[model samples]
Target: MDETLREQQLRMTRFIRDPHANLPPPGIEARRLAVYRQLFLGNVQGLLAGSFPVLRATLANDLWQSLVEDFYACHRCRTPLFTEVAGEWVGYLESREDLPGWVAELAHYEWIETVLLLSDSTDPAHEPEGDLFNGVPLLSSLAMPLAYVWPVSQIGPGHVPQKAPGEPTLLLARRGADQKVYFSRLAPLAYALLVSLREQQISGREHLETLAELAGMEWDVLEPQATALLLDLKAQGVVLGTYSG
Candidate 1:
């Protein structure tokens, strides 16, 4: 590429990021640039706002925009396209220290819903037999584990809800047949077991044995809770099938 073209391409990135810059084009005039500027930021803000409605509700519009702007400028996205901006936006939130800790956590808490909803993961296609706990392995890939410092589920339009849950919240972010994402809470032990199962290639029984040891719960004692959790995981579209391997 020509040096001028390269620099101009860099500037286009900077311009889109800055949101107050001139639109770069022969056809884009001053008024056109202004329109594009607002339209561009508005689209980003709307997608982010949709993902984080509760967090947006916490801040005034300008404040929220400023927060989004800060992340927009500071982070270099791994993706080539602009439409897939939320991943970088979420990464920025989780990394920045200048922002309020709760806000960053809340932003990540919200962004996860969009990530799962838009996921293209198609690896797990095994049918559920619904006997998830009969000495069979259980896991959830479609239903992912998330632990957040801020309890984002409770807040809504009407009121400023509690900042954190009474305990650390273990959430399962799952996608439905229609591709909508839903949040479900899990017990800590259950969450740990699910995570271990999904991560390793161990047989289902071996995974439970390892998990039980890790949790310091005797397998005999935790058997019921573990079984119940596996059944729930199956119902929620996480477990693909019994681990025969």
Candidate 2:
């Protein structure tokens, strides 16, 4: 006999799920129900396709359109503010254990540029005080250190052809002194160090030691590569500040 709140909520959710579903909930106008549906779907599609331009070009439009719809319908975004929908898209792939291995990796690669551009940091992340070779600081915000199980950025025009690359590519994306964006491929060890430092919450210098320890690599070999990685991270504006005492 009672109109349950749970039932009402589900009814409202259906309106969002099916754009054309006609429901006259007070704030929403019945006559223009389809407009809101189309508008919401359109904006999301643009961002998704824009981030994965190469992938969008590769897939049939219908398939691509369906992908965006699935993401919209299922994803409960962490950030409601949405300046970084692209980052959340990357997060979606990074967290999904069930995704096809190649598909998840490619999504991460395709979404990288969007993540960098929409990163709202006016200043770089904290950099630590240390010497290169003696020990080096690793990268953080203001710079985006990226790793993919596949080489997404390198597959431009025809380099990797239609399928995934045999090897992974390490990418460093950062804003320069002049505020221009740059991306460079990194060596596996350097990428491992940067990724460990950023995503794993390991400190820069310690992360290098981590790689060396894990691989039984001589710290001597890690020293120069880690040093180079830090310098490049700083020059690219990755270091926001020196880690303080």
Candidate 3:
């Protein structure tokens, strides 16, 4: 590209991204610039609104618009894909200190749906009906165990928490075989077990024994309860049975 043309393109992009702080390119008419600015900002806002419906509905209209506008102006997104815009928006919210403490957490909680829906990865090779305790347990590639300080799942227009609760919230987000995403609350032990499964490729029995030690209980006593929990996870599609490979 020519040096002058490159500069002109940069100016136009800067103005479109943040009209208040930037001047339009020299040849563009103010009427045309306004159209371009609104078009770009509207596209960004629409993507974010769809991705974070709960957050969008919880905040006042003006505040939400302002927040989106600020993100458009200030954030330098790493990706050009529109589908990934929500993730970028979450990163922007996480970086900001001016917004409410729960804003980033809520945005992230909402963004997980988009991530799982668009993910291309498939579950690893494993026996769907294999024994979970004897073989290495297989956690579905699409299943994610998340811990948030705020009750992100319960937050909405009707329920805005003033302060975070004493205990962190443990939630499971998974993409089912039907191509639908689901969210559910998780008990602390359940969360720990899932996290361990995700982080370490170990047998279910070993995982349970470790958990029993952590909880200060004998393996014989915890085995029944842990086995039941594992069975339930398998039924829910969160646990894809024991690892076969």
- Kindly list the per-residue Cα lDDT of model 1 for residues 172-220, writing each as its tens digit: 7887888788888878877787787767756556667777898788999
Clashing pairs in 3: none
TM-score of each: 0.76, 0.66, 0.94
Candidates ranked by TM-score: 3, 1, 2
Candidate 2 residue pairs in backbone clash: 124-240, 125-240, 127-241, 127-243, 138-204
Against the unseen true structure, what C-alpha lDDT does each candidate score? 0.69, 0.64, 0.91
Worst 10-residue lDDT window, candidate 1: 126-135
How much is the lDDT of residue 33 in candidate 3? 92
How far does residue 205 in candidate 2 sit from its true spot (Å)?
7.5
**What would you estimate as the lDDT of candidate 2?**
0.64
lDDT of 2 by residue, 136-159 (tens): 344556566676766666554344
Show where candidate 1 strays beyond 4 Å. Answer: 1-33, 124-138, 156-166, 243-245
Best prediction by lDDT: 3
Best by TM-score: 3
